[model samples]
Target: MPQNKAAIATQDAPAAIGPYSQAVRSGDLLFTSGQVGFDPASGALVSGGVEAEARQVLKNLAAVVGAAGLQMTDVVKTTVFLADMNDFAAVNAIYAEAFAGAEVMPARSTVQVARLPRDARVEIEAVARFA
Candidate 1:
Protein backbone atom coordinates (compact mmCIF):
# COMPACT_ATOMS: atom_id res chain seq x y z
CA MET A 1 0.00 0.00 0.00
CA PRO A 2 1.15 3.55 -0.75
CA GLN A 3 1.63 6.06 2.03
CA ASN A 4 -0.31 9.29 2.28
CA LYS A 5 1.69 12.36 1.37
CA ALA A 6 1.01 15.94 2.35
CA ALA A 7 -0.03 18.18 -0.51
CA ILE A 8 1.47 21.65 -0.66
CA ALA A 9 -0.69 24.73 -0.21
CA THR A 10 -0.67 27.65 -2.62
CA GLN A 11 -0.96 31.40 -2.21
CA ASP A 12 -3.48 31.40 -5.00
CA ALA A 13 -5.95 29.99 -2.51
CA PRO A 14 -6.90 31.18 0.94
CA ALA A 15 -4.75 29.62 3.62
CA ALA A 16 -6.31 26.97 5.80
CA ILE A 17 -8.03 28.67 8.73
CA GLY A 18 -7.07 25.89 11.08
CA PRO A 19 -4.58 23.13 11.56
CA TYR A 20 -4.93 21.43 8.22
CA SER A 21 -3.18 21.33 4.92
CA GLN A 22 -5.15 22.45 1.90
CA ALA A 23 -4.82 19.02 0.37
CA VAL A 24 -2.92 15.80 0.74
CA ARG A 25 -1.56 13.52 -1.99
CA SER A 26 -1.03 9.84 -1.49
CA GLY A 27 0.30 7.84 -4.38
CA ASP A 28 -1.68 9.29 -7.27
CA LEU A 29 -4.65 10.48 -5.31
CA LEU A 30 -5.13 13.95 -3.84
CA PHE A 31 -7.77 14.87 -1.31
CA THR A 32 -8.60 18.49 -0.58
CA SER A 33 -9.92 19.90 2.62
CA GLY A 34 -13.17 21.81 2.40
CA GLN A 35 -12.69 25.37 1.20
CA VAL A 36 -15.05 28.17 1.98
CA GLY A 37 -15.78 31.51 0.30
CA PHE A 38 -12.75 33.30 1.65
CA ASP A 39 -10.74 35.28 -0.85
CA PRO A 40 -7.02 34.61 -0.85
CA ALA A 41 -6.03 38.23 -1.11
CA SER A 42 -7.74 39.27 2.10
CA GLY A 43 -8.27 35.86 3.68
CA ALA A 44 -11.82 36.85 4.42
CA LEU A 45 -15.14 35.71 3.13
CA VAL A 46 -15.95 37.30 -0.18
CA SER A 47 -18.89 39.59 0.23
CA GLY A 48 -21.69 37.86 -1.66
CA GLY A 49 -24.62 35.57 -1.57
CA VAL A 50 -24.72 31.86 -2.27
CA GLU A 51 -23.99 32.19 -5.98
CA ALA A 52 -20.91 34.31 -5.50
CA GLU A 53 -19.77 32.29 -2.53
CA ALA A 54 -20.06 29.10 -4.52
CA ARG A 55 -17.88 30.53 -7.27
CA GLN A 56 -15.20 31.48 -4.76
CA VAL A 57 -15.28 27.98 -3.32
CA LEU A 58 -14.61 26.51 -6.75
CA LYS A 59 -11.88 29.01 -7.41
CA ASN A 60 -10.20 28.01 -4.17
CA LEU A 61 -10.52 24.34 -5.04
CA ALA A 62 -8.99 25.00 -8.44
CA ALA A 63 -6.05 26.71 -6.80
CA VAL A 64 -5.41 23.81 -4.43
CA VAL A 65 -5.64 21.30 -7.26
CA GLY A 66 -3.20 23.35 -9.30
CA ALA A 67 -0.78 23.49 -6.39
CA ALA A 68 -0.70 19.70 -6.41
CA GLY A 69 0.75 19.87 -9.93
CA LEU A 70 -2.59 18.86 -11.37
CA GLN A 71 -5.23 20.61 -13.37
CA MET A 72 -8.92 20.77 -12.72
CA THR A 73 -9.31 18.03 -15.34
CA ASP A 74 -7.62 15.63 -12.97
CA VAL A 75 -10.44 15.77 -10.51
CA VAL A 76 -12.51 12.57 -10.25
CA LYS A 77 -14.83 13.30 -7.37
CA THR A 78 -16.18 16.11 -5.18
CA THR A 79 -18.28 16.85 -2.14
CA VAL A 80 -20.21 20.07 -1.76
CA PHE A 81 -21.70 21.49 1.41
CA LEU A 82 -24.33 24.17 1.32
CA ALA A 83 -26.03 26.05 4.07
CA ASP A 84 -29.31 25.63 2.26
CA MET A 85 -30.54 23.28 -0.43
CA ASN A 86 -32.38 26.15 -2.11
CA ASP A 87 -29.09 27.16 -3.66
CA PHE A 88 -28.54 23.75 -5.22
CA ALA A 89 -29.53 24.66 -8.76
CA ALA A 90 -27.52 27.84 -8.78
CA VAL A 91 -24.48 26.11 -7.36
CA ASN A 92 -24.81 23.25 -9.83
CA ALA A 93 -24.94 25.62 -12.76
CA ILE A 94 -21.75 27.38 -11.70
CA TYR A 95 -20.04 24.10 -10.93
CA ALA A 96 -20.93 22.73 -14.36
CA GLU A 97 -19.48 25.77 -16.07
CA ALA A 98 -16.29 25.48 -14.06
CA PHE A 99 -15.78 21.84 -14.98
CA ALA A 100 -17.16 22.21 -18.47
CA GLY A 101 -13.88 21.42 -20.12
CA ALA A 102 -12.51 19.04 -17.52
CA GLU A 103 -11.15 15.88 -19.10
CA VAL A 104 -12.74 13.80 -16.39
CA MET A 105 -16.19 14.83 -15.32
CA PRO A 106 -16.10 13.96 -11.64
CA ALA A 107 -18.76 12.16 -9.68
CA ARG A 108 -20.16 14.44 -6.96
CA SER A 109 -22.29 14.56 -3.87
CA THR A 110 -23.74 17.71 -2.32
CA VAL A 111 -25.27 18.05 1.08
CA GLN A 112 -27.16 20.70 2.96
CA VAL A 113 -25.60 21.55 6.27
CA ALA A 114 -26.74 23.53 9.28
CA ARG A 115 -23.63 25.68 9.29
CA LEU A 116 -20.09 25.99 8.08
CA PRO A 117 -16.98 27.81 9.13
CA ARG A 118 -17.20 31.58 8.74
CA ASP A 119 -20.93 31.14 8.31
CA ALA A 120 -20.32 31.05 4.60
CA ARG A 121 -22.99 29.78 2.26
CA VAL A 122 -20.88 27.19 0.50
CA GLU A 123 -17.90 24.95 1.01
CA ILE A 124 -16.39 22.49 -1.46
CA GLU A 125 -13.76 19.79 -1.45
CA ALA A 126 -12.46 17.50 -4.16
CA VAL A 127 -10.45 14.38 -4.89
CA ALA A 128 -8.14 14.19 -7.88
CA ARG A 129 -6.03 11.51 -9.43
CA PHE A 130 -2.63 12.25 -10.88
CA ALA A 131 -2.11 10.64 -14.25
Candidate 2:
Protein backbone atom coordinates (compact mmCIF):
# COMPACT_ATOMS: atom_id res chain seq x y z
CA MET A 1 0.00 0.00 0.00
CA PRO A 2 1.11 3.53 -0.64
CA GLN A 3 1.88 5.76 2.29
CA ASN A 4 -0.37 8.68 3.14
CA LYS A 5 2.45 11.18 3.30
CA ALA A 6 3.53 14.38 1.65
CA ALA A 7 6.84 16.23 1.59
CA ILE A 8 6.77 19.79 2.90
CA ALA A 9 9.16 22.51 1.83
CA THR A 10 9.54 26.27 2.01
CA GLN A 11 12.20 28.76 0.91
CA ASP A 12 11.85 30.49 4.26
CA ALA A 13 13.80 27.61 5.77
CA PRO A 14 17.19 26.22 4.84
CA ALA A 15 17.21 23.55 2.24
CA ALA A 16 18.16 20.04 3.19
CA ILE A 17 21.81 19.28 2.65
CA GLY A 18 21.23 15.60 2.10
CA PRO A 19 18.50 13.24 1.00
CA TYR A 20 15.58 14.44 3.01
CA SER A 21 12.67 16.78 2.83
CA GLN A 22 12.40 19.75 5.13
CA ALA A 23 9.36 18.06 6.64
CA VAL A 24 6.87 15.34 5.95
CA ARG A 25 3.18 15.22 6.77
CA SER A 26 1.29 12.03 7.45
CA GLY A 27 -2.28 12.09 8.59
CA ASP A 28 -2.58 14.90 11.13
CA LEU A 29 1.06 14.95 12.12
CA LEU A 30 3.94 16.85 10.60
CA PHE A 31 7.52 15.73 11.21
CA THR A 32 10.29 18.20 10.56
CA SER A 33 13.86 17.32 9.81
CA GLY A 34 16.58 18.70 12.03
CA GLN A 35 17.19 22.44 11.61
CA VAL A 36 20.47 24.14 12.37
CA GLY A 37 21.37 27.83 12.49
CA PHE A 38 22.06 28.10 8.78
CA ASP A 39 20.50 31.15 7.17
CA PRO A 40 18.23 30.01 4.34
CA ALA A 41 19.41 32.52 1.80
CA SER A 42 23.14 32.26 2.38
CA GLY A 43 23.28 28.67 3.62
CA ALA A 44 25.81 29.71 6.22
CA LEU A 45 25.67 28.96 9.92
CA VAL A 46 24.65 32.05 11.82
CA SER A 47 27.58 33.65 13.62
CA GLY A 48 27.13 33.34 17.34
CA GLY A 49 27.19 30.92 20.22
CA VAL A 50 24.59 28.35 21.17
CA GLU A 51 22.05 30.99 22.14
CA ALA A 52 22.02 32.59 18.72
CA GLU A 53 22.11 29.24 17.00
CA ALA A 54 19.22 28.01 19.11
CA ARG A 55 17.14 31.04 18.21
CA GLN A 56 17.73 30.52 14.50
CA VAL A 57 17.00 26.84 14.89
CA LEU A 58 13.60 27.60 16.35
CA LYS A 59 12.88 30.04 13.59
CA ASN A 60 13.76 27.44 10.97
CA LEU A 61 11.58 24.86 12.63
CA ALA A 62 8.75 27.37 12.88
CA ALA A 63 9.04 28.05 9.18
CA VAL A 64 8.60 24.37 8.46
CA VAL A 65 5.67 24.15 10.87
CA GLY A 66 4.00 27.10 9.21
CA ALA A 67 4.52 25.52 5.83
CA ALA A 68 2.47 22.62 7.05
CA GLY A 69 -0.35 24.94 8.07
CA LEU A 70 0.39 24.48 11.74
CA GLN A 71 1.50 26.78 14.51
CA MET A 72 4.14 26.45 17.18
CA THR A 73 1.35 25.52 19.59
CA ASP A 74 0.70 22.50 17.45
CA VAL A 75 4.16 21.13 18.12
CA VAL A 76 3.81 18.02 20.22
CA LYS A 77 7.43 17.00 20.60
CA THR A 78 10.97 18.09 19.85
CA THR A 79 14.46 16.64 19.91
CA VAL A 80 17.36 18.99 20.46
CA PHE A 81 20.97 18.08 19.74
CA LEU A 82 23.78 20.15 21.11
CA ALA A 83 27.46 19.94 20.37
CA ASP A 84 28.24 20.87 23.95
CA MET A 85 26.15 20.01 26.97
CA ASN A 86 27.42 23.11 28.72
CA ASP A 87 25.37 25.24 26.37
CA PHE A 88 22.18 23.61 27.54
CA ALA A 89 21.19 26.49 29.73
CA ALA A 90 21.65 29.01 26.98
CA VAL A 91 19.80 26.95 24.44
CA ASN A 92 17.05 26.18 26.94
CA ALA A 93 16.53 29.85 27.66
CA ILE A 94 16.09 30.68 23.99
CA TYR A 95 13.88 27.66 23.51
CA ALA A 96 11.55 28.74 26.29
CA GLU A 97 11.06 32.13 24.72
CA ALA A 98 10.38 30.64 21.30
CA PHE A 99 7.44 28.58 22.44
CA ALA A 100 6.13 31.05 24.95
CA GLY A 101 2.37 31.75 24.83
CA ALA A 102 1.64 28.41 23.30
CA GLU A 103 -1.45 26.62 24.53
CA VAL A 104 0.67 23.62 25.52
CA MET A 105 4.41 23.30 25.45
CA PRO A 106 5.77 20.38 23.53
CA ALA A 107 7.67 17.52 25.14
CA ARG A 108 11.39 17.62 24.42
CA SER A 109 14.56 15.58 24.59
CA THR A 110 17.98 17.21 24.57
CA VAL A 111 21.33 15.56 24.28
CA GLN A 112 24.89 16.48 23.51
CA VAL A 113 26.35 14.95 20.41
CA ALA A 114 29.93 14.57 19.25
CA ARG A 115 29.31 17.09 16.51
CA LEU A 116 26.75 18.30 14.02
CA PRO A 117 26.54 19.06 10.33
CA ARG A 118 28.66 22.10 9.44
CA ASP A 119 29.80 22.11 13.06
CA ALA A 120 26.59 23.72 14.23
CA ARG A 121 26.43 24.33 17.93
CA VAL A 122 22.81 23.23 18.04
CA GLU A 123 20.15 21.60 15.94
CA ILE A 124 16.42 21.06 16.54
CA GLU A 125 13.65 19.00 15.04
CA ALA A 126 9.96 18.92 15.86
CA VAL A 127 6.75 16.99 15.49
CA ALA A 128 3.52 18.91 15.16
CA ARG A 129 -0.14 17.96 15.09
CA PHE A 130 -2.72 19.55 12.84
CA ALA A 131 -6.24 20.28 13.96
Candidate 3:
Protein backbone atom coordinates (compact mmCIF):
# COMPACT_ATOMS: atom_id res chain seq x y z
CA MET A 1 0.00 0.00 0.00
CA PRO A 2 1.08 3.54 -0.69
CA GLN A 3 2.16 5.55 2.34
CA ASN A 4 1.90 8.95 0.71
CA LYS A 5 -1.06 11.04 1.88
CA ALA A 6 -2.87 13.99 0.30
CA ALA A 7 -5.83 16.35 0.62
CA ILE A 8 -8.50 17.23 -1.93
CA ALA A 9 -9.78 20.70 -2.58
CA THR A 10 -12.26 21.74 -5.24
CA GLN A 11 -13.52 25.11 -6.39
CA ASP A 12 -16.73 23.52 -7.59
CA ALA A 13 -17.79 22.92 -4.00
CA PRO A 14 -17.95 25.20 -1.00
CA ALA A 15 -14.67 25.69 0.78
CA ALA A 16 -14.22 24.90 4.42
CA ILE A 17 -15.26 27.83 6.54
CA GLY A 18 -13.10 26.90 9.46
CA PRO A 19 -9.71 25.17 9.70
CA TYR A 20 -10.41 22.17 7.51
CA SER A 21 -10.13 21.02 3.94
CA GLN A 22 -12.98 19.96 1.71
CA ALA A 23 -11.94 16.35 2.01
CA VAL A 24 -8.99 14.24 3.08
CA ARG A 25 -7.86 11.10 1.29
CA SER A 26 -5.76 8.54 3.12
CA GLY A 27 -4.96 4.97 2.35
CA ASP A 28 -7.93 4.44 0.04
CA LEU A 29 -10.38 5.97 2.47
CA LEU A 30 -11.97 9.40 2.29
CA PHE A 31 -13.61 11.31 5.08
CA THR A 32 -15.71 14.42 4.51
CA SER A 33 -16.62 16.79 7.28
CA GLY A 34 -20.16 17.80 7.97
CA GLN A 35 -21.37 20.03 5.16
CA VAL A 36 -24.04 22.66 5.58
CA GLY A 37 -25.98 24.74 3.06
CA PHE A 38 -23.47 27.54 2.67
CA ASP A 39 -22.06 28.05 -0.82
CA PRO A 40 -18.30 27.97 -0.59
CA ALA A 41 -17.76 30.42 -3.41
CA SER A 42 -20.23 32.99 -2.18
CA GLY A 43 -19.81 32.12 1.49
CA ALA A 44 -23.54 32.52 1.96
CA LEU A 45 -26.47 30.27 2.46
CA VAL A 46 -28.27 29.03 -0.64
CA SER A 47 -31.41 31.06 -1.09
CA GLY A 48 -34.37 28.81 -0.27
CA GLY A 49 -36.22 26.88 2.35
CA VAL A 50 -35.59 23.44 3.75
CA GLU A 51 -35.77 21.57 0.47
CA ALA A 52 -33.45 23.96 -1.28
CA GLU A 53 -30.94 24.09 1.57
CA ALA A 54 -31.00 20.31 1.82
CA ARG A 55 -30.31 20.05 -1.89
CA GLN A 56 -27.37 22.41 -1.56
CA VAL A 57 -25.95 20.39 1.31
CA LEU A 58 -26.20 17.20 -0.75
CA LYS A 59 -24.62 18.88 -3.75
CA ASN A 60 -21.80 20.14 -1.59
CA LEU A 61 -21.25 16.65 -0.20
CA ALA A 62 -21.15 15.29 -3.75
CA ALA A 63 -18.47 17.78 -4.67
CA VAL A 64 -16.37 16.85 -1.67
CA VAL A 65 -16.84 13.16 -2.44
CA GLY A 66 -15.79 13.77 -6.03
CA ALA A 67 -12.75 15.69 -4.83
CA ALA A 68 -11.69 12.60 -2.90
CA GLY A 69 -11.66 10.70 -6.24
CA LEU A 70 -14.90 8.96 -5.49
CA GLN A 71 -18.53 9.14 -6.45
CA MET A 72 -21.74 8.97 -4.46
CA THR A 73 -21.75 5.23 -5.11
CA ASP A 74 -18.47 4.99 -3.25
CA VAL A 75 -20.00 6.33 -0.10
CA VAL A 76 -20.12 3.57 2.49
CA LYS A 77 -21.82 5.43 5.29
CA THR A 78 -23.56 8.68 6.14
CA THR A 79 -25.17 10.52 9.03
CA VAL A 80 -27.87 13.09 8.46
CA PHE A 81 -28.97 15.65 11.01
CA LEU A 82 -32.12 17.67 10.60
CA ALA A 83 -33.62 20.47 12.60
CA ASP A 84 -37.10 19.06 12.40
CA MET A 85 -38.63 15.65 11.99
CA ASN A 86 -41.52 17.16 10.02
CA ASP A 87 -39.11 17.65 7.15
CA PHE A 88 -38.29 13.97 7.00
CA ALA A 89 -40.43 13.06 3.98
CA ALA A 90 -39.50 16.22 2.12
CA VAL A 91 -35.83 15.84 2.86
CA ASN A 92 -35.87 12.14 1.97
CA ALA A 93 -37.39 12.93 -1.40
CA ILE A 94 -34.49 15.16 -2.35
CA TYR A 95 -31.91 13.05 -0.57
CA ALA A 96 -32.91 9.99 -2.56
CA GLU A 97 -32.48 11.82 -5.84
CA ALA A 98 -29.10 13.21 -4.78
CA PHE A 99 -27.60 9.71 -4.92
CA ALA A 100 -27.94 9.66 -8.72
CA GLY A 101 -30.36 6.77 -8.86
CA ALA A 102 -27.96 4.23 -7.42
CA GLU A 103 -29.42 0.84 -6.52
CA VAL A 104 -26.92 -0.04 -3.79
CA MET A 105 -27.37 2.42 -0.98
CA PRO A 106 -25.02 3.20 1.86
CA ALA A 107 -25.88 2.62 5.48
CA ARG A 108 -27.44 5.77 6.89
CA SER A 109 -28.91 7.28 10.03
CA THR A 110 -31.20 10.30 10.23
CA VAL A 111 -32.09 12.18 13.34
CA GLN A 112 -33.76 15.40 14.42
CA VAL A 113 -31.58 17.82 16.27
CA ALA A 114 -32.21 20.91 18.35
CA ARG A 115 -29.87 22.99 16.30
CA LEU A 116 -26.81 23.03 14.07
CA PRO A 117 -23.97 25.33 13.24
CA ARG A 118 -24.93 28.34 11.10
CA ASP A 119 -28.55 27.54 11.84
CA ALA A 120 -28.73 25.27 8.83
CA ARG A 121 -31.80 23.14 8.53
CA VAL A 122 -29.72 20.15 7.56
CA GLU A 123 -26.17 18.92 7.64
CA ILE A 124 -24.45 15.81 6.25
CA GLU A 125 -21.15 14.03 6.64
CA ALA A 126 -19.95 10.99 4.73
CA VAL A 127 -17.29 8.29 4.53
CA ALA A 128 -16.11 6.61 1.34
CA ARG A 129 -13.51 4.11 0.28
CA PHE A 130 -11.55 3.88 -2.97
CA ALA A 131 -9.23 1.29 -4.44
Which numbered prediction scores highest in lDDT against the true structure?
A: 2
Candidate 2 global TM-score: 0.98
Measured by TM-score, how close is model 3 to the native structure? 0.89
Global lDDT of model 1: 0.91
Predictions ranked by TM-score, top down?
Answer: 2, 1, 3
Where in model 1 is the C-alpha error above 4 Å?
1-4
Q: How accurate is candidate 2 locally (lDDT)?
A: 0.94
For residues 1-131, write the lDDT of model 2, one tens digit per residue. 99999999999999999999999999989999999999999999999777778889999999999999998999999999999999999999999999997888999999999999999999999999988
Cα RMSD to native, each candidate? 1.5, 0.7, 2.1
Query: Where is the poorest 10-residue window by lDDT in model 1?
Result: 1-10
Residue 128 displacement (Å), model 2: 0.3
Judging by TM-score, tell me the better candidate of 1 and 2. 2
What's each prediction's TM-score?
Answer: 0.94, 0.98, 0.89
Candidate 3, pairs of clashing residues: 14-40
Candidate rank order under lDDT? 2, 1, 3
> Top model by TM-score, which number?
2
Would you list the C-alpha lDDT of every candidate in the order shown? 0.91, 0.94, 0.86
Instruction: Write out the backbone clash pairs for model 2.
Output: none
